[model samples]
Target: MAKISVLSPFLVLFMVLMSSAPVTGQDGSRRQMVPAMFIFGDSLIDNGNNNNIPSFAKANYLPYGIDFNGGPTGRFSNGYTMVDEIAGLLGLPLIPAYNEASVNQVFHGANYASAAAGILDATGRNFVGRIPFNQQIRNFENTLNQIKGNLGAENAATVISRCMFFVGMGSNDYLNNYLMPNYATRFQYNGPQYADLLTQTYSQQLTRLYNLGARKFVIAGLGQMGCIPSILAQSASGGCSKEVNLLVKPFNENVKNMVNNLNANLPGARFIFFDSSRMFQDILQNGRSYGFSVVNRGCCGIGRNRGQITCLPYQMPCPDRNQYVFWDAFHPTAAVNVLMGRIAFSGNPDFVYPVNIKQLAEL
Candidate 1:
């Protein structure tokens, strides 16, 4: 694996070439890198699917999208998610939430991310009204049917095969389910054992997506969740929790191995694993060089580390939002999101293996 820096000359060249591409569409690009981009994940990538749900996980109010063009759109960040940035890099418009997307919009893509959602159905039961990954996939099938109705079965299959699928689930499974006291998961299995359990379920879900005409996949591993403001607030020393970080290591390892297995066994399918943990580690370790001042607390929210709760409606966030690594207790600010997105777009194999999103699109 090539551990390339963000300033790698090759990455600089790649960006130059991409920016120089011809313009034709309403967007600046001549053509989209892919036919469509389907997103599946939790609040980290959720655009607005949780708005109407009867859940406490919703984020449709102010200070949330203060930096966004359309204002708060249920995105947990001040502006865009990593996927939103990736979508723009792909030369496509931002994908709409599954609930809000029109049939016409489905041709481009739809986001099925729900806040507090997870890979397991029961993972976020405490949230009351989140759509789990399985339900999200069912919703995708509905969208696929619409695609087939409009484009015909054969054409739809061909187009769908070329579409990109961005999946970034499992954070909620750790944060909301397995770690919660109300849930019996911790007692049932130890850390590594629990990770194995989650991975088994995750493997099956990816296979299901593959069976549903998905060919190009970008499976994002869990980030450095233990270092999140929420976990930092929980720590007695007010430092990142090693115990919490260790728990997700096996999960990421298993997913990387799973990506390899899937690519080898699945015919015509190509999958890439995004090493989100490593990427975040780089940011945390070099926050100063990255131009960040606050790496331990959220720009919004109150209490210890400003992480006891997510940001509230109409809450006044910090003035220097870009200097803060966290937007809230659990989410990264747009600054971090965009950095991670672009890195995944063209980072070396150490970050996204065996090829980055741009290379995968070309294939």
Candidate 2:
């Protein structure tokens, strides 16, 4: 394999030229921003990596992707995911799950995300089986090796560095760890202390990606976890839990800081932090503005608030999925995902700070 130092110049020149040039597709109808997109994190972007796992976090059945053209390809949403929208905006095809990707398919990048996965390995023990952030990075390493084998080391380095990485994680850490009754993380550390621990670990994980030839990154922050239907169902009035929301603030703050530090510290590394909290809050505060009527309840699922239980196989979902913000208990519907993707792709500084996805891809 070619060494990092040997491939640095080619990677740098390639990125510079690609950034300045307008990427076009075969039909020449749209401009392709990035060569490919690589995804990480949890259920929010799992695609289908969890389908073969032993965990109950799978989502490859009916009512899950009814809105999607392929129909339930293991995406938690009804149609597309944030990654899908972002890939579409970049003029690239939908990336395949890492487990199902063939050698040829991997040239477009892979999705190693898994449901119930978190930044910490122990974060999703309740689900029994998951590819944690650490293991996901390892999977990416294997991907890098495969790319090197396919395209030769220099071309592989250039392709990998030029590709975009979208990471949406950390919610499970709060839901499955700090907030779980069986877990002692809450007692072991306060909100701020736990956030600090998560940030420290996250910094290392990102740095590992940087070392593995990833240069462009889109890191999404945690949304209003307390406002999700599942959490709201726990309340008597079905109101969002202020306590839970407050607990997540520290983690988001730390993540933003971590991004800033990475940009300043890592040469050639361009990162964008997507503010999911503000994005979700805007939709919840003004649902009608976004064409959403039910921001609190999920379109699918059972019981009060339609969140006591998740959307099971053969269960009928809402008539109009676009009218609902959330698809199931904890995941957003495809409508909201596409909205978030558009914002991340070209939204102003308000949603994506420092730089948006378009700017990052161009760089």
Candidate 3:
């Protein structure tokens, strides 16, 4: 005799709704993998923090967010930044910029990223006004207080511990500091010595977050700065600048070593270093494989390689934004941002070492 189990009417409806929900995994399990995604970085993931700042690094105008739902929301890309894609992939809502976030909004997460920001406070002084990494950390401390007031200390602490802290800085330190002809950073320290100094400061900045209850970190290494349209345009041959690329290599190496040391020394501290340089190099070396027709030129800038100057207001970008890797002289297009997001989320060990964001979130 065979026994048959029939579901109740309410049970049947529940099962149907659960099956139709968008939060289900491939194995049909329902989950919200992460509590939140607290982001801090430079223009690469700055949603709109730079808008209020009186800085030339602002990007809250047309052509910036042409591909985003709420157009021109101050993202440096054509649409969503890497964090936006990563948040969506995590089944979380888009994180709001720290300047614009309400007390209630802090539950989902907050973005402290700022255009022209760097790991060092003095890194982006040319911008006139920008939230440096130290200032951004202070902003997060304020957010933490708000969260504590909203959810009470214990619950807020739990949220903070569970949240993934993403950091993608240092590029501006090179572009706007070390590389700037007038800046004294170049004369003060050469490549390796500068890299060492940056790493030391960065290590302390990260420790600040760790002390504040951030247990999981996703640290993005500096990408190949030499291959950006701005650098490429500097050369008559329009070739990638080997010298500039060599300059950043030691920095990236030091960053990885710092991560390893942090993980070993800090109890319960877990880190996943995203090898952005390798990922960008891969795309530049094999644009065809990534559905990119233009890798060395900006889609909306002016002059040679479309990168002599940044994309101006009312500027007409390339017809096919997906075909271009860069949106402006220095930032990536939305398509490229999305690709990087996916790679950081679930790419191989080559891109995300030790573990990917997905694995870190699960942890």
Top lDDT prediction, candidate number: 1
| Global lDDT of each candidate | 0.89, 0.86, 0.86
Please provide, for model 1 over 1-363, each residue's C-alpha lDDT reduced to its tens digit, 9 standing for 90 to 100.
123355644345335634753222125643688999999999999999989989989889999999999899999999989998888888899899999999999999999999989988998888899999999999999999999999999999999999999999999999999899999989999888988888899889989999999999999999899999899999999989999999989999999998999999999999999999988877777676567878899999988999998898899999999999999999999988887887788788878999999999999
Report how far residue 182 has shifted in candidate 2, in Å: 1.0
Report how far off residue 351 is in candidate 3 (Å): 1.5
Displacement of residue 195 (Cα, Å) in model 3 is 0.4
- What tens-digit string does per-residue lDDT give for candidate 2 at 1-363? 111223332233333534643332122356777878889989999999999989989899998889788798999998888888788778888899999999888887899999999999998898998999999999988988988987899998888889999998899999998999999999999999999999999999999999999999999999999999999889998889999999999999999999999999999998889989987877677676456788889999987788899999989999999899989889999888877777777666676888989889888
Estimate TM-scores for all models: 0.93, 0.92, 0.91
Worst 10 residues of 1 by lDDT: 21-30
Output the TM-score of candidate 1.
0.93
Total clashes, candidate 2? 0
The backbone clash count of each candidate, in order, is 0, 0, 0
**Winner on lDDT (1 vs 3):** 1
For candidate 2, what's the RMSD? 9.7
